[model samples]
Target: MWSRSDAPRIMIVRLSAIGDSILTLPVLNALRDHFPHARLSWLIADYCAPIVRGHESLDELVEVNRGWLKSPRTIKQVRRRLHDMRLDVTIDVQGLAKSALPAWLSGAKRRIGFSRADREGREFSTWLNNELVHPSALHVVDRNLGLLKPLGIDNPTVRFDVPEHPSEIKAASDFIESRTLRQGFVVLNINAAWLSKRWTMERFAQVAKYLADRYGLASVLPWGNEREREDAERVAAKVPSHAMVLPKFSLTQLGSLFRRARLFVGSDTGPLHLASAVGTRCIGLYGRAVDRSGVYGPQGIVICHNHTSSDDAMRRNKDNDAMRLISVDEVCQAC
Candidate 1:
């Protein structure tokens, strides 16, 4: 273990995937409490950096844009950039080569990361870390906090200070008002990164119809891409009540909408996790490909399909039988 200093410079590496990035919140909070006066920095990918960009607990955010380090010249540039930080300790929560390489290059004296058994690696990232953390079967958030144990932060508390935006909140409020929707609106996200996790549009329409008829709730379907927008449109067309397809909004605006929503229903995706982070009630529709362990919060009501032994098929997004097992009534009952 590294000896404690008055103001040790620390860097945390977690890159990509909105859900994984959000799960790293507790780690950041725990580090803040353990070393209140220490200089804390985070190395993150450009895409998902917006969520934690202007965070109050962070001293700096080192952004790595897409395809920056594919070439040897760029890799050296990245190495030189991190070397300039003079990081004393580097904690890598993302157990991947892409994440580990940068942390190793940061010139940190104590490079702490996951054990080899924790995750797969082609880049042999585990060899780079001076310290290894054996992971438990805990939720991803708890597991992230576990990385702090080596740094003398034993009792890591879970805290996610989601950066607030009043302007975005107002914009969300205005958009909802324009749709003549008060607070009791259910935001439906009908998309996922994998096809296996995405529920049928027919099922989403039925759920929307049921919620509208039973609870007098309007449904707002938010889409990220053209395919999702098309799916949202299809669901809206089929629903019997106030279901509308929402235009694209920034991540901050989406957070504001989730905060105002009475309920959030979606497949196992980033928005479902985002809604949970913002203290919104969410029913996460998950498939067998999704890891239900440690991902859901207390406010999240997860309804996952039974386990299947088709990992290969699920990876190819060829098997959606797991998602099919979740009935519309089951989702309504949870809501």
Candidate 2:
């Protein structure tokens, strides 16, 4: 292990989904808090780089294109980059093969990672690290913070401040102006990457209509892909004309839109997590996954339930079914 006085250059690896990446920001913040003088860099998937770009706590953001990693030319590029930087402490927060390889190849004097028993990475990957942190059953936020335990850094209440951009502010303003939604609006994201996790289109329509009729709040539906756009349109068809569909937005633009929204409602997806991260009042729907490990909801009205049968619950654990059984009325009531 390197001495704290060595002033080591640190590299953190967490090439995961957007929400997972966002959830890791607190760890990054805490690392910065503990080692105020360390030159910190991050290795993240290409898609997630934008979220942390220009972050004040991070000294540099390295983009790892997964598609390129599959090619020899790309591997050479990555090797060259790592070779040139020569990190001192490489922390693998993703705890997976994809994230492990980069940290292992970085030639860092000391590497730290979560243990396989923690379900963060495979057993062999632990061998690549100089230090292995076997995490206990805790929230993912805390699990990530546990990596710093060996370094004598124990701050747990780290906060994430997502950077704001002028372009995004303009985009959000343009969207609001073009739509003429002058009154305060509720932003509802109706899409998820997985089909099993998405609520039915009819269910979304019912929720949107209820929010409009009962609350007199205009609903804005933001969709990413074609299928999601179709779903958004279907939901919009059932609500008032003032309830409109938003076009695809970049990460910064989405952040801007989220900031302007009074409340947000959506599935347990990246955008939903994005809303929560931005401190929006969020009501999330989760039917196929566990929210305790990754999803965050603000105080007062975050709704989650389980719908699985006894056998399925036994297989997945009743605690994992927190979001599966939440009904429309339950969520609406929470809202």
Best by lDDT: 1
TM-score of each: 0.93, 0.89
Q: Which regions of candidate 2 fall more than 4 Å away from where they truly are?
A: 1-6, 307-324
| Tens digit of per-residue lDDT, candidate 2, span 1-335 | 44455456888898878888888888888877777788889999888988899888999888977686789888888878987897888888888777878888888878899887735657467878878898874567778888988878875576878878888889999988887766778888877765445666666677777777788778899987788788888888877564688888887789889888888888767777777778888877766435344356443244545533232225333342344455777766766
Candidate 2: residue 217 lDDT (0-100): 79
Per-candidate local distance difference test: 0.81, 0.76
Q: Write the per-residue lDDT of candidate 1 for residues 198-306, one digit (tens) a residue.
A: 7888989988988888899999999888888888898899974669988789887898899999999987677887888888998888776345232466787778767
The residue-level lDDT of candidate 2 at 94 comes to 81
Scored by Cα lDDT, where does model 1 land?
A: 0.81
